[model samples]
Target: MRLDASAGGPSGAGLPARLVWLCVALAAGVAAIALGTATWALAQSPGPAPTTVGLALVCAAVASIAITAGAAACVHRLARAHVRTKASASAGQPVAGQQVEVYVGLARRLQGLVHREIQLLDVLEAQVEDPDLLKGLFQVDHLATRIRRYAENLAVVGGAVPRRQWSRPLPLVEVLRSAIAEVEQYARVRVVPPVEGTVRGHAGADVVHLLAELVENATAFAPPHTEVTVRARRVALGVAVEVDDRGLGMPHPEQDRVNALLADPGRVDVGDLLRDGRIGAWVVSALARRHGITVKLQSNVYGGLQAVVILPTPLLGDRPPARPPATEPGRMPSRGEPTGTATASSSMAGASPSPVGARHHPPAPPALTRAASPATAPAFRDAVASGQAPRDAGAAGPLLPRRTRQAHLAAPLTRGGPGPVNQPAGDHDPTLMADFLRGASSGSGEPPAVRAVPRH
Candidate 1:
């Protein structure tokens, strides 16, 4: 496990022998000084015989040992003081980081509230169809998205997860446009033909944020009269998103620093953010590192910036045919684009109706309890007759929870269904469930009362 294993072996064994010689030289220096002092004392003595000279020599040796020990002690003390100073200086950094942490916590809390509001807005957008209202909601959504982005920067730097997930793979083009939408000058930006594909759900957030940062830099630094262009290409290792601008490119040193950070963003410390002039770059680098992505910044031919982001194969999903758009530089999809998905049944031709649909209708599940008209009652009747359990317990896959499948079956049937089933402890008899559905579906057994309780 040790790379220096050979350093302790035969080859390197004597490499440290010079240390022994150095110690010997130190000892000789001490002895020589002692001898000199002994000679001086012998010369100064009034009457020095052999015994007195020998006694002087002994005193000199003692003095030399004391002096050598004192020197070693002083060396150790100086070393200890230097170490303490360095440690103290390093300790102060965490105190400053703690202050930043307070703000980071506050920022994340605020982000959570804003994110909740964003979720509500998403629900509203889905439920409402009025164009005027949609436009206002759309703008509000954009504003919230920006707020969330800044919040995410704080959270990520503070070492926290941002908003909730996108739940499923998102259209790659849509995610790219969403990133562009957050830019200040989105209108001037153009997206060339992109590889029609989808991005994995969890990676969607990072990819979007990363692209947004690059696109923001492109549009923000570019000349006001020029447009920023986004392009994509399929590469051998992965897919690359390229943002091109005609603005002044970065100086060599800054580009190198940015590239270094992007190459290994773990080297970035949150405490160092204050000294950084480019928080956008920091965020991009950190997020890219988080997602195992590679981002490279290159100077374009026209002395502009080109940021190429390479995403690995795992992040890509359901890649359709590689085709360029008929219209180059296509704008983001407008509000007129349909929000709904077309189902196979909806697309089928020559559909004839029975009670609910064609002569053949899939039997309703056994769990539904909703009241039905006499014509529709037959489906429920068939359901009672069939008494079928869910075929694939988790047929919904990752989209919906297993418990929600029961709601998809039983709860929606009743006019005033037992809203959410508050099941009692240890009873899951399928027959009991079916009976309960039937009871809830049917009107009360008592006859209707004819009297009006109150006349205003």
Candidate 2:
């Protein structure tokens, strides 16, 4: 198969340049020898040998310059080829800009699919009131969120802007909570109190994406079940968010290398990231760069790596307008609110609003435990701790499952008619509605009893 010349693969272009340089070096060597001999002959004649020798010497100097230039060019070409060969070997594939485009395109397609999947899940969650089934849906929802993050990472690394944009600035704390919601081990993450600030609407999505990557990395690398704390504080440049874990810290040298990469991600080699499985680092770097944010890694008092992300003043914004209550005047807002507005859901659930990584939804009903199996035990535990469920084999299929809209069609049929089948229904309580309406009329619309039900 022919390799692409631009991909740093073996190419005839390099060969020609090297060959040309080698030929030039050889010719220069010959010319230098001939000039030296001529100079020697002029010196032997002893007839104004200085002038003759000077002319020969100048010619030899020119030839020497050619020899040096040619040799240097040949060596440089050889070195580049060697580096490319090693990189290809390490990555197990050619590292090229085209491959990056391919990945970016794939990521974009996956993003669309995942977005649709989340929408479908939102519909199912609204229709189904079975606590166990709802648990499964939440798990699927969280997983889809994680997948979306991965896709965003690829897009960002490929220089793709986030498609989702917020019309208004979001509270920095709300953004942090949304980020925690995207990680697999969100249960283990904690947020310090009083996260005060807001990110500009234009940069809000990218900032959230960047923080999610950092939080995800912290959660994954930290010891299982250990706490990963995320906190934000005012800084001279802007606001600095710190994600600190308690796992074994990296060596100073390794930490320095990572800090350097995060500081100037452009210097990173894609092949090295592929070889080392450091795509998360690259994603964080890319997002940070887009908004002029600064990211760094350092050892913390907890004896683990602390990732500090500094959002510059430009990306920061004044506090946004107060979020509306989950319950509108006469009706309730559907649970299908975009992930960016999840704070409204959180506030309605009576979850503490101070901590950024605090719970967004109420705890799952006990019925979720019934779907537990040896295979899903870990996910179940994570779900319980996080007030969310992990994907269950019994509840949903491998890749985001599409719940059949006409599920009744699957029921066995008898001679008279189909067997009785249970139908999904929204979690609604007539009494709760009456009370909510009464409170709304009285202009004191307190949360109602139905708030006990989890709404994602």
Candidate 3:
């Protein structure tokens, strides 16, 4: 459509009036020169004045038309060249490269910051025992992951290779999970059990980025509360991952156009895609091209678009074989050795049963050389909740029952001094509360009933 609109040059309907005036002036100049030359020739030839005048007028008219045609052609050709140059510039080869460089630098810095933030969040989540606090930390970590993903995409678009690489091939299931974790609506994404396979260490990051873009798009465009299903399987060529969503599918023309863009993303204008709000597709294409991965979109049986990405054989790696348990050389099996089942059964049979209503307790934490510090409360609570040993040396003391902060409050109660009964009923009475707690802990003296005071 843009091509058709720009086909006409200065001579077309949209031509500026000034160009027409310039052509007219040139033609008039040519006509005047032709008339003067004709008059001079007539004077030299000694012909009839009327006939010479008539011939000169005819010559002038012919010269004007010829000059006008030549000038118009030249103007049209120049106009066309100018338009082509402008179009090429607007398509974003030079300008886009500069912008991409700037963006790539910023993205790299952002990635570093987000990476550190994620590490902090992980530590906090591990140390915090409250379920609510842990949930909030998880949310923050997820957002950080998303930010890192955007930074990585920007770097990829700028032709920057990923700095981090896995030392060994990662399982296909884990890759998909990592991708899914970056999406905003990841909870709605349902991943089918993938066949056993591993992605090559070099290409795993790109593959994860590619799949993340696809899954994000699916989750964004799918109907609210609908699940976006992702499936992976091994194919003859390599491994294929499919993302299906129940969104409104595009028309055949739009699909073809997008497919063509993905097929040869280099030919498409990055600026144009950015303007059209299709940067996701461009990012996916760029990543796929980098790793020799193939991405295609087609209509699925469910009347939605299905994006299928094929990781070529070079990007796929075989799962390493499981290593056998290390054993002493030349060691023979003993007949007295009990199998796993027999050992478990014997242990269970020899264990004594507990009495009814008795509370079960975890194994005692290892004793600390010194008492627990006040700061160790959080770590101690986390370990106790998880049923694990105290992580801190000072946290071991918290595992055993002890009263550290109530000694001052309970001193007067233990001394059996007379209660301050003359104090106002409306005022807070700490002595009565402390006495109640002391009696409860000691399981001896009856707790004194205190009158309830109403708030104003």
Provide the lowest-lDDT 10-residue window in model 2.
1-10
lDDT against the true structure, per candidate, is 0.49, 0.53, 0.52
CA deviation > 4 Å runs, candidate 2 = 1-99, 267-270, 320-456
Q: Return the lDDT, model 3, position 168.
A: 44
Roughly what TM-score does model 2 have, to 2 decimal places?
Answer: 0.50
RMSD of each: 28.9, 27.1, 29.4
Which pairs of residues have clashing backbones in candidate 1? 354-357, 367-410, 368-410, 369-414, 370-413, 370-414
Clash pairs detected, candidate 3: none
- Please report the candidate that would top lDDT against the real structure: 2
TM-score between candidate 3 and the true structure: 0.50
TM-score versus the correct structure, for each prediction: 0.47, 0.50, 0.50
Error of 1 at 307 (Å): 0.4
